[model samples]
Target: MPVIDFVTDEENLTMTVTAEFAAPVERVWAAYSDPRQLERFWGPPGWPATFTTWEHTPGGKAQYTMSGPRGEKSTGTWEFLAIDAPHRFEVLDAFANEDGTPMEGFPSMRMTFEFTPAGDSTRMSSTTYFDSLEALEQTVAMGAIEGTKMAMAQIDAVLQDLRDYAQGKGTRVELLDDTHVRITRLIDGPRDLVWRAHHDPDLVRQWMLGPDGWEMTECIAATEVGQSYRNSWAPVGDTPGEPFGFEGEVLLFDAPRRAVTTERMQGMPVETLNDLNLYEEDGATLVTVLIEYPDKETRDMILATGMADGMEASYARLESAVLTPER
Candidate 1:
């Protein structure tokens, strides 16, 4: 877990805060660009921010307000100075009246948000420039650094969810035994969303797509124990191969937590027992999927088919398609 780093250099009249997230560069940029996503974490832990008007264009304006736990309110406005997709943005931040009008004679701070690729993650660097050392010192003395750190800390969960939605490799595989395997993923979302993603047919079709150009055509699922469910997949276009489908029976069902299911492919010989477990940590979800094979040969055969890789892709699609919507 990476924390936000704050640097203040009053001599240069500049301040900076940087944080890293386990997500792609584009997703990080989206959080800042989208008003709804921005409202989710723009303020410190105690103060909640809401965006009333946001326009992501040069020369445009964004207006938001932060309300304290005891109902105190502070409004701020941003005048966009520059815009670059998925890389950087610059804005002039100013104190504003309740109606979003900038207060006269109040000094404004210019800030730039930068997103850079760090391996599979993104490093976000925000630099705020002040007109004078006095302004910088005044802002710092007003708990700017600590407040910024607190606000930046909220990006991790948001970025993780965005990453999972953008690229489906969030799931990891672990061999439990010769006849059993476990798949786990750190879902940067609530347990309920994850549960709905699995049980809801509309959401299931978003990420349960199989192979390239193949989409889930039919998904009928019921999580009640002993209930039968079926899913089918077909090519998006008229390509080679006929459509295939499978049916499964739920052995155990626990809403938003765990489930046990038995499944067999249309022409497969053995029935695979799958145990799905979801645990909540803070605001994130830990998903563990245990598959119990009847024998080592069956497990090996399934693994050889690149089962794990396919699931990763599917889950990624699920996150990006079902979890992250265009703002």
Candidate 2:
């Protein structure tokens, strides 16, 4: 893959960047072409931009303000140089004052993006040509590299979210063998009640714990497939404890029914898939769980760690909550 790369010339005072994404060319193009979607994941993480105008065509103009933390803001404009759907786009980028005036002492540059097909992913190369090496060096010194890294990371996250939203209906986890420890439990409750047990953070904390004094520190339910949530668990007994633990993402979120899933880490690792199915039968709900790990070692470890016990307990808590009288 033609991953993101930044090249600077000391003698000429110029810089260029190239990066790729694991998506189709068309899919990648939609992100850049759609102003609303672009704003959703644009700029660095936590610093989103507001698009004033976007004319996505050759010779058209795009204006936006990039806002930083503490209300710091910089407006900019891009004059489209070329446009080829799902393939190529070129534009001029410049720094400007918040009032839309071009900033003095800031050099404008040309940005060219080329999208190429690489199997199931799109190799996107974005190159920015500065006027001189001084400009490139000065920009780099101003934290351009770190900012770009954050921006690309945001893009990756947004793309993954988009993919998850598109494939929200089906389950991502597949069952491999019967020895993988699959279980199905039927609860005598309405679908809404069962759904509430999984969707509510407080309810989730009640059931998802080990036999000892483990407690959930943080929990968030996205209520959508491919959306992510984090649950932190800590030991509270008289024994020693792990510093921080417990993390997972929503792989499948079928409201009133089931969820499929995986664990999210800071960086990439071997993929693990989990499938949860919910169905209503005779005024009650039945939940089926299927977990798939990369290898036997992981599967064995999960089983030995009392995962099923915790799950059963969590469901029991859910049952109690459903059966409890309304106050």
Winning candidate number (TM-score): 2
Q: Estimate candidate 1's RMSD in Å.
A: 15.5
Query: How do the residues 6-45 of candidate 1 rate in per-residue lDDT, one tens digit apiece?
Result: 7888788899888888888988888889987787679865
Error of 2 at 263 (Å): 27
TM-score of 2: 0.52
**Candidate 2 local accuracy as lDDT?**
0.66
Model 1 / residue 232 / CA error / Å: 52
Each prediction's RMSD to truth: 15.5, 12.8
lDDT at 188, model 1: 63
Where does model 2 exceed 4 Å of error?
1-4, 11-13, 161-327
Query: For candidate 1, which ten residues in a row score worst on lDDT?
Result: 160-169
Please tell me which predicted candidate would have the highest lDDT against the true structure.
Answer: 1
